[model samples]
Target: MLIDTHCHLDDPTLLASLPEILAAARGAGVVKYIVPGVAPEGWDGIARLAEEWDGVCPAFGLHPMFAGLYDEILLTRLRSFAGRAVAIGEIGLDYLAEVPRERQQAAFRGQLRLAVEAGLPVMIHCRRAFQDLLAILREEHVQRVGGVMHAFSGSPEVARECIGLGLYISVAGTVTYRNAVRPLEVVREIPLEHLLLETDAPDMTPEPHRGRGNEPAFLVEIARKVAETKGVTVEEVTAATTRNAVRLFRLS
Candidate 1:
C-alpha cells in the first residue's frame, strides 16, 4: 500500500468530495494520507477530518506563504492542538513568497521550537530557500524529533544533507513530468529508505492528469515514476515509502 505523506484534503475542492476521492484512492492502493495545515483557521477542519476518517492523519502549522497571518496567539493555539497532531507543519521558509524573509523566519522558527517541545515530527515546505531552511533547522536541532521535507524540490546534494539531518525527502507529482530532471536525479541518488511520496492534492498534478486537480489516487503515478527512476519495482517503491511515512508520522 502507498501512503501519501502530504496532501491538502482540507482544501475545499477535495473536502467537498472527500468520500468519493478517498474511495478512489483506496482503489488505487493508496491507503493513507497526511493532511497538513496551511493556516490557523484551517487547523480545526483538518483536525476534524482526521477524527472523522480512518486513514487520514492531521498535522498543524502555518505555511510560510501565509506568514502574514501568524501571531503569538496562534502559536498558543497551535500548542494546544499539537498533542492531537501527527506533526507540526507544513511549515518552513519560502523565498519565492512575497512575504519578507524576517516574517517567514519568525513563523518558521516559532513552529520549529513548538515541534521540539511537543515532541512531534515536522512536515516542512521549502522553495528557493534551502540555505536558510537548513541553517534554521540545524540551529533548532530538528534532528531531535525528525521530519519530512514536503514536495522536496532540491538538489541531490541537498537531499543527502536533509537525510543526514534525519529527515525524509518527499517526492511529488512533479517527478512524473517529462521535464522533471532534478526530481529524477534526486530519486536516483537518494536511497529508498530516505524517500516518501505525495500528490499535494488539488495541485502538482501528475502526467496524463496534469490539468486536473491532484488527489491521493494520483500518488500511484508518482510511485511508478520513482520506481522507474530508481530502477526498482513499483511495489518496492510503495512498500519502502509507506514504511518511511509510518516511521516519520508514527502512523498506527
Candidate 2:
C-alpha cells in the first residue's frame, strides 16, 4: 500500500471532509498518511487526528512561513507534544518567503533542539535554504532520529548530502508535473530505499489535478510517476516507499 509521508490534513478544507478524503485515499490504495503540524495552533488538532485515526500519524513544529507566530514558550509546548507525536516537523528554513532569515533560523534551531531532546525524527520543510539548513544540522551535531526532507527539490548532490546525514528525500506531487524536470531528476537519482512519497495535500496536486485541492488519495499518481521514473513496477514503488516511511518514523 502507499503511504503519504507528509500532508496537512488539519487544513480547513480537508478537515471539513476528513472522512470522505480518507475513504477516497483508502480506496486508492493509500494505507497511511503522516500529517504535519504547521504552527503552534495546529498542534492539538494534528495530535488528536493521530489519536483518532489508525492510519494518520502526527509531526509537530513551527513552519518557517509561520515563524513570526512563535515564542519561546512554544518550544516547551512542542516538547510536551513530542511525547505523542511521530516526529517534529514541517520545520526548517524558507529563504524565498518574506520572513527574515535570522528569525527563521532561530525558530528552526529551537525546534531542532526540541526534536533532539525528545529523540523524535524530524519532517523538515526546506525551501531555497539547503546550505544554511545543512550547516545548522552539522553545527548542532544532529545525528540522532534523522527525518525526511518533505517535498525535496534539491539537486542529486544535495540529496546525497542529506542521505549521508541520515535523512530521507520525500518526493511530492510536484514530480508529476510535466515541466518539473528537477524534481523528476531527483527522483531518478535518489535510491528507492532513501525515498518517500508525499502529497503535501491541499497543495502540490499532481498534473491532471493541478489547481484543485490535493488529497491523500492522489498519492497514487505520485507513486505512478516514481515507478515510471525509476522503471519499476507500481507495486514495487509502493512497497519500497511504505517500508522507507515505516523505518523513518518507527511506525508499527
Candidate 3:
C-alpha cells in the first residue's frame, strides 16, 4: 500500500467526490492519505474527514498565502488540537507570490514553535524561499521534531541541505513530467530512507492528468515514476514512502 503524504481533500473541489476518490485511490494501490490544514476555515472540514475515514491523517498550520489568518486565536486552537492531528503544517514560506514576507515568516516561525511544543512533525510548503526557509528553520530549530518538504522543487544540493535541516524530501506528480529535471535528480540521488511521495492532489495533477485537478487516486502514477527514476520496483517505493509517512506522522 502507498500513503499519499500530501493532498487537499478538504477543498470543495474534491470534498464532494471524496468517497469515490478514496475508492479509486485504493484501487490504485493507495490506502492512506495525509490531509494538510492550510486555512483556519478548512480545519473543521479536514478534522471531520479524519474522523470519517480510517486512513486519513490530519495536519494543521497557517500557509504562507494565508497570513491574514495567523493570529493568537489560531495558535491557541492549534495548540489545543495539535495532539490529535498527525502533523502541523501545509505551512512554510513562499516568495514567488506577492504576499507579506515578514508576516509569512512570522507565522511560519510561530507554527514551527507550535509543532515543537506540540511534539508533532511539520509539513512545509516552500516556494522561491529555500534559503530563507532554511535560515528560519535553523533559527527556529525545527529539527527538534523534523519536517517534510512537500512538493520539493530544488536541486540535489539544496535537497541535501533540507535533509541536513532534518526534513524528508517529498515529491509530487511533477516527477512524471517530461520537463522535470531538478526533482528527478533529487529523487534519483536522495537515499530512499529520506524520500517520500505525494500527489498534492487537487493542484499538481501528474502527466496525462495535467489538465485536470489531482486526487489521491493518481498517487500510483507518482510512485511508479519514483520507482523508474530510482531503478526500483513500485512496491519498493510504496513501502519506503509508506514507512516514511508513518514514521514522521506517528501514524498507526
Top TM-score: which candidate number? 1
Which residue pairs clash in candidate 3? 202-214
**lDDT, model 2, position 235:** 93
lDDT of 2 by residue, 196-232 (tens): 9999999999987988899999999999999999999
- Candidate 3 lDDT over 48-148, as tens digits, reads 99999979988888889997678898899878778678899989988875778998988999999989888888999999999999999999888999989
Counted clashes in each candidate structure:
0, 0, 1
* Residue 115, model 2, lDDT: 85
Better of 2 and 3 by lDDT: 2
Residue 250 displacement (Å), model 2:
0.8
CA lDDT of every candidate: 0.94, 0.90, 0.89
C-alpha RMSD for every candidate? 0.7, 1.0, 1.0
TM-score of each: 0.99, 0.97, 0.97
Of the two candidates 1 and 2, the one with more favorable TM-score, higher being better, is 1
Error of 1 at 144 (Å): 0.2
TM-score of 3: 0.97
Q: State the displacement of the C-alpha of residue 151, model 1, in Å, after optimal TM-score superposition.
A: 0.7
Candidate 1 clash total? 0
Ten-residue region with minimum lDDT total, candidate 2: 137-146
Alpha-carbon shift of residue 151 in model 3 (angstroms) = 0.1
